[model samples]
Target: MFTDPIADYLTRIRNASRAGHRVVEVPASNLKKEITKILFDQGYILSYKFEDDQAQGSIKIALKYDKMTKEPVIRKIQRISKPGLRKYSGSEELPRVLNGLGIAIVSTSHGVMTSKQAKKEKVGGEVLCYVY
Candidate 1:
């Protein structure tokens, strides 16, 4: 069993995008909310809203697409650090996605952030996922 909620979150979005769904919903958690925020901030997603229903809360995400091209903004998303094989990196060893064109979301001591932000903050932790 994977038991990786983060990976589940990413796969849900990926499946929805492939199905051309405008909105996708996932069971909510603080970590998922932070990741959604990062995706929104990086322009990979259009918007997101968190619905609180106690332990049954969820997140609604608006997937982004190019207006003129009708192509998804996020071309690829991959879970880099699995629960079985964790990947950790220091600030200097952070992965550069697509030669800086894409972003690697990292869970740092400071917080979950894009690799660029991590580099700027001079910290690093788990390399969570890659988005391009």
Candidate 2:
């Protein structure tokens, strides 16, 4: 059984990219879906879709690649919150990944959003992950 699905999700994508896989499948959950959406919106990933199954569903992600360099768009992905230690932050204390070059996914009261959006909306939440 997976103790941390978010970490698993990120690891799956990371491994797939390292192996030069175009796509990777992960066990689905609402949080995972939200994270996937955030990644797509930030242009780190190409696309994703959820498939229904008898048990929990599955998510298929189309990894992104550069046209000229043929390199993975996302160079790194890090999970902040975990089952043991839950990290939270306010809008003012929100992190700027790579001096704003990367994206930090935050789970706010308004819902899951990027640190930039959370800051704009003046909300604080648990720091989910940082992506570059």
Candidate 3:
């Protein structure tokens, strides 16, 4: 569940899809930047990282729900890890990769996940934004 303008914007997109309207893709270069601005203004994304040498990077984002916040205080943005990579078993193992990327993971009722986690969980929803 998202709030206000962003939520409304996504609704419009969804509605457009239902009505069979052609939707244009936002340019990739500005996609992360725009998301960062939105999340920063809304206090969702806390921080982020980017590197030329690193094919993989991560960002820390927060999940706000009815007065409860989880630990690590951040989350990572990386390629989805398959079940084979989960050495410890269970979603709990995800934090290790996130931590290695300088990300703090927050597990919520939504599930133990990250921006990358959503995909792994096969859960499709809006990506609130990126932190950096």
TM-score to true structure, per model: 0.96, 0.96, 0.23
Candidate 2 regions exceeding 4 Å error are: none
C-alpha positional error of residue 95 in candidate 3 after TM-score superposition, expressed in Å: 12
RMSD vs true structure, all candidates: 1.3, 0.9, 17.2
Residue runs of model 3 more than 4 Å from their true location after superposition: 1-3, 24-114, 117-132
Q: How would you encode candidate 1's per-residue C-alpha lDDT over 3-117 as one tens digit per residue?
A: 8899999999999998889999998988899999999999999999999976769999999998998888999999999989999999999999999999999999898999999
lDDT of 2 by residue, 1-132 (tens): 888888898999999998889999999999889999999999998999899973988999999999999999989988898889999998899999999999999999899999999999999999999999
| Residue-level lDDT tens digits of model 3 in 37-95 | 44444354344333234343322223322235332222323222222342123343334
Q: How close is candidate 2 to the true structure, as a TM-score?
A: 0.96
Query: Model 2 residue 86 lDDT?
Result: 98
Residue-level error in angstroms, candidate 2, position 47: 1.0
Model 1 global lDDT (CA atoms, 0 to 1)? 0.93
Error of 2 at 113 (Å): 0.6
